[model samples]
Target: MSDRLFEHSSQGVSRGLSAGSPGSGRRLVVEADGGSRGNPGRAAYGAVVRDAESGDVLARAAERIGTATNNVAEYNGLIAGLRLARELDAAAHVEIRMDSKLVIEQMAGRWKVKHADMRRLAEQARALVPANPTWTWVPRERNKTADALLNAVLDGGPPVWEVGASASTPVAADPTGRPAEETAPAEASAPARGWGAEVGGATTLLLLRHGETERSQAKRFSGSGGEDVSLTERGRAQAAAAARSLADRLGVAAVVSSPLRRTRQTAEVVAATLGLPVEVEPGLAETAFGEWDGFTFAEVGQRWPAELQAWLADTSVAPPGGESFEQVLIRVRAARDRLIRTYGGKTVVVVTHVTPIKLLTCLALDVPARAAYRMELPPAALTEVAWFADGAASLRSFGVPAEVPEDGEPIHG
Candidate 1:
């Protein structure tokens, strides 16, 4: 029986015998678990090391990791487990069991550790156990012991341990573990972190495409260069529906819009309903189609087939005298940065045109620039993206109609 099992601290064992001590050759199994109530909210981890031969609990470690992602918490648990194992018997062969497939796969070198924070944590855990202990991914149900300990610590229960248990005789256990599936927030609404594991609330943007304009209905090119067009009557109705859908629901800190008339008109409706003023962002304007402005796709195809094909094939290709998708991305990226800086951790509603909306959606989804061509967002459709402190984005919902009710009741946007 390890003497270190009974002692406890948030950072793992506070007192322990020397490593590689007498009777330190026994194999060990380390099970670890971690979670955050709100994902990026309050977070903690728990780990338990046991004798592989006897299943006797050797040591337990847990700690509150403050605001962090679930991935970060999982890595912390692994680190704590490895540290506890080293204290008990540095030379013992250890098997690490965790429910996190990403952690296990990354540590095993089978999957790429793309996230910077996760890579750092994985490196730390590896440094502690230089030989790279056997990594195994178990289902959450199989890691009940550590899961319970984690929840206990999170619930403010003091860490306790029952060491020196009879290997063959099972004793009474205080298993108060809850399944992670039942406890964790659904992935859709949960704030996502970046590779750097951004902490704290995100700057959420409720991106809204403006209602249809005459140019849009006519299937003609409408760009910032053309005479700014207003919404049609149907477009006006769509804007009103969207405004009512979002006004009380998003809790918008500010309402921002494209400088163009169509977007401004849509923004006005939302601002008026929400009782918030509209801030014009020129960067959110439609693509500058230049000579192609007001021209139908068929007309452009017939007149400038080569140029049209080039523009379609490449994001850097612009119309005869206008901006490219790449250019739009650059300015939109800047706009996103400025907005996040101005309204960090607050929800902001952005009323803009199709190109900018698609570009922003691509950025949030972390896809290629060509992704804009693949997506179709209906007018007055609401798309959401939560930008974290570290510049990572969590795409919540996409193309949700503003005025549509799913259950016959008005839904808070």
Candidate 2:
């Protein structure tokens, strides 16, 4: 065994240790971090342990795992750090830190992990320590070593130990380690959004598209210009019918709507049944179809075949004076952030357009914007998003129940 691992190594033998010395009742400090390039892409986790007294690191670990999420990576990190601490059988306690809020929350019992992948990962992480330890959720800024280890795995670097201060068998890091870097400044405060606001309570948003409009029936492109378009008689009946069907099921706390007349009219019907006023969210407006506004599908496909093709293939393509799907995504993301930030953890009914609804679906699916064009939204439709506090969002339901018919008809919306 290394002399430094003994109870009476000279201070010179463990000069770098800062937290504690090599004696009984000493505590351990652990830092763990995880990363995935494409998120659900290639993933890795890393962790390191330093002697409390001499401040010298004792052991280093990193693992390249199969495909996993950022949360999965984080759990693996916790697992790695826990295992490292376990190897030091005499250590009475450990102070742990990580960058993932979900891991911190789930481990802290403040959030529920419903995904099978995360559930398994969480079980493994719990297997590390005895289900409890001193832990904190630090931002990416404070976690340098573990973050570096994760990056090393992602950057095509050699195996985990190729760079860290790990070479000889259980050796001391140095007589005096390079002075610790200045501690990162504290991050500006940000209130929790979505699910993490409360312990075990998830904030859910019920997203519903507006009822049919004249443009919807005509199959014309309706953008910002159709702000004043009124719903047809059929549309009005559809909204009222949907309201009656949804009222008993969705105990909506608030009714939020787009500023457009069609959307406002749709909101009125839903609000009437739910007994809530419509709060206008201007950011959730539909795509500005520009010169393509009021043009039927056949007209656009005929007159602007090349432009239309480009728009379909590439989300950035704009038809004459209209907005691209990318623009719509940016705004809808802002709208989602705002709503989740403002009414977090509460069920809010968002009555809006097809494009915005599809955007929410896309965000939940985490797919590219081009994929939105492939989404089909029936009028007066219902979709549900369970927004988690960890900045993670989930799609629980899409397009309402198939049994939900349009108006009196048995055809589903």
Candidate 3:
């Protein structure tokens, strides 16, 4: 494999022993695996290198990479394994074995790398490829060594090796090889952040409800299946007001929005003011209300009274041919997790609809899904939630009004 597959910066690149230098012409085997408990939560990776000839272990590496997806962790495992092999023998004929088919195929050039994060990781792994490298897909059972290492780390054991360290170095252990006191899980010694004490930095999400649509002004059910509505004049004014408010905030890293027209229009106003592009997150779109779309609550009650009652009484019940609260919760949760993973330690503005914003608020507060009904989200309102590395969330504000100037002029920060 060519070393110049990607032309990235020299920063953060690990360059090991040169080819034909010492520790050359050897054969090595690298096994790797990674996992996440909640898909994008509490992630880690493990990798082990072995002498191909004697079947003896050469090095082991594992680490807890907080808040990542399974695919990201797996790519990390591959990178760690490749790095270890390079340290042992840079010119070795390396056999890279991984349990993730996605990583394997992507690395081997058979599958395309899609996610931006995955593309970066694939590039790093490619840079570490040795001479005559062979990519192999192994079953999960055959990757037990690496899996065990990751599990041990996740279970509060010391990391086998630290990042940028050679194979011989260990981390978070004393001279006697016992885990250090500081290495204990935060919950064991420190009080939960939810109880009042602050821990590490958090990813703050500023959730902005979309501006007023015609349906919104009329108290109609405007969902994904309904007409793709544009922002009314009042909605445009509200969006402009929101944009002015957001422009004053520092460290506003990204502006994300639902794919629907109203949310996109609102997001565009904010993004343009903040000098950032709008990123669409489909999970933030309004719920599919099916046949109930574009109807008033009273109209729905008159037509599908049983369905509406079931949906209102039970979170799992769907409107006729529509999505259930439970279903929206699942998708919204996934999108929230992805945003947390992608924008950790940063502030992101999420422009979405009432249901998604309410769902996110419910999640941050650890309230029942049924509580969505109790929340009052007005048009172009803002809610703030901070998500920490340890999975604790703090609700900072809710339903803050987006104030417009009385003279109908643009409000500047």
Using Cα atoms with residue i matched to residue i, what is each candidate's TM-score against the true structure? 0.52, 0.53, 0.56
TM-score of model 2 (CA atoms): 0.53
For candidate 2, write residues 1-413 as lDDT tens digits: 32322222221111122234344566676778887878788877787776655656665565555466787677777876776666554344565667776776787666898976576567656656532255566667657667766665455432232112331133222334311222222221122334535344456878888877888988889989644688887777777767776777655688899889888998998898888888999988888898889999889999999888877765545668777675576567657766775786788889888899987777665455566778788778889887665334568788872233445443334
Q: Can you rank all candidates by lDDT, best first?
A: 3, 1, 2
**TM-score computed on alpha carbons, candidate 1:** 0.52
**Which scores higher on lDDT, 1 or 2?**
1
How far off is model 1, as Cα RMSD?
Answer: 17.8
Which candidate should be chosen as best, given TM-score against the real structure?
3
lDDT of 1: 0.74
Report each candidate's C-alpha RMSD, comma-separated, in the order given.
17.8, 17.9, 13.0
User: Candidate 1: deviation at residue 255, Å?
Assistant: 0.5
Write model 3 residue lDDT over 1-413, tens digit each, in one string: 34523322422111222223233667787888999999888888898887777756777777666667899889878877887777566777787778787887788787899986687678767878865466777677667678877877677654444222234332234555443332445454323345586778899999999988899999999898779999988889999999999888999999999999999999999999999999999988899999999999999999998888878976646677777675686568668867876898999999999999998887676555678999999999999999876555788999997886666444665
Worst 10 residues of 2 by lDDT: 6-15
**Candidate 3 ranges beyond 4 A from true positions:** 1-195, 405-413
TM-score comparison, 2 vs 3, better candidate: 3
